[model samples]
Target: MDLRTANMEKNWQLLAGGDRQGLYACFDLFYDDLFRLGVSLYRDVDLVQDAINELFLELWKIRERLGEVRNIQQYVITIYKRVLYKSRHVRQEFASLDECIEMPQSSYEEALIAIQTDERRKALLQQALQQLSERQRQMVQMRYYEGRGFREIAETTGLTERTVYNTLHNALQALRKGMERVE
Candidate 1:
């Protein structure tokens, strides 16, 4: 085996054998690159850091059972991707609840109140949306309110598809937080 692969195999064995220093060494080798990947994928440094920390903690917990990883770098990245996916799924679920709340049917008097309530909700949402940067607000409006696809938004806005997705993701995150505060 090559030198780096050999070194990684040795470190993996040591970690699986429960060597504390070997665990630290593995972390030192992998954390920075993993953090960079996480940040690029998630767009939130704090959330990425939390994901990395949780990933290492889980790795430590299950190290003994992890068994014979051929490539430690790939293995760690696979685990990290899973963690990031789960984190994103959770955030989307909670944010969807806040952003897409449903209303029930009511009588005329209640309907009038509902109309006023809807107006207030729209004002609150507008205030929340205003807090985002102009680019983010535009991306969000195009994607969510205007019913444009990412590719269409990209074409119209002169941004790449990935850039549109990232901008809308950050915008939605900010809108969720702002709406929470407004409510």
Candidate 2:
């Protein structure tokens, strides 16, 4: 393993073992990457920073229960995405009353329908994700969620570029088939 990966793994193990410095080390190592990911997903610097802070706090609270993680970045990122998305949803829910009142009834109705449709699509996508094998799911997330190129994925995953491509291709096909079945 490379020095960076080795360092992350060591810190991950230390965090699991109840070392506060390990947690600090991990936060320092991953903060920038996570911040970039958060901003890319939501485009709100404050919200992204808040989400990252919350994520580390939660991790520290649950450190002992985390057990072994094969890939620390991927694991933390998956949790971070959930936290960021949930935060965004909560913010939307508390939007100003005046804003709601200012919208016309027809426009409000259309917005509600659009939101419902989006919810349905999200549910369908979740179901599709569940159908994929663990490896395929990882590849899909790295490629789409983290926006990593195939070569980067291959290097990080220790898979050949061709294998990464094939895995992602098959994953997309499976997702397409699953969505088609639903439609």
Candidate 3:
């Protein structure tokens, strides 16, 4: 493993062993990445910060029970996504009465079904994304999630524009096939 990955694994082990410093080290190492991911999912800085803090606190609390993680970044990200989504959902639930009334009213069952369907689709998409190569996934996120242009992505990734386009195209094709297999 490279220096960074080795360091992360060491800190993860320390944290699991009940070392406080390990918690801090892990926080320091992952803060920027978690922040960026939170911001990318939701534009609210305060909400993102709060979610990240809560994530670490929960991790520390459950440290002993946590099992070995092969990919710490991905594991944290999966948990972080759930936390961030729950935070956002709670915030929306408390929206002003006027704002709430402005929307169309649906029965509880209908809303529940819609939510389940959306969650299923999201899960499927995530699985499909995980099937892609790292470079393909990165390019896909830049082009779609970050709304970056082909030229800009090419410049930032040190890849030619044509290469970026081709990569994205292949990624999309792969994603389609993956999703289709499920349906």
lDDT of each: 0.80, 0.86, 0.87
Model 3 CA deviation exceeding 4 Å by range: 97-183
Give per-residue CA lDDT, model 3, range 1-183, as digits (tens): 899898998998999889999999999999988877776667566678899999999899989865577778898898899999999999888997677645444544554466578899899999999999999999999999999999999999999999999999999999999999987
Q: What's the residue-level lDDT of 51 in candidate 3?
A: 96
RMSD of 2: 15.8
Q: Please give the TM-score that candidate 2 achieves against the real structure.
A: 0.52
Q: lDDT: which candidate is best?
A: 3
lDDT of 1 by residue, 60-110 (tens): 899987667766788899999999888878766777655865544344445
**Model 1 Cα shift for residue 18 (angstroms):** 1.3
**Candidate 1 wrong stretches, greater than 4 Å:** 1-3, 95-183
Worst 10 residues of 1 by lDDT: 103-112
Look at candidate 1 and tell me the lDDT of residue 94: 76
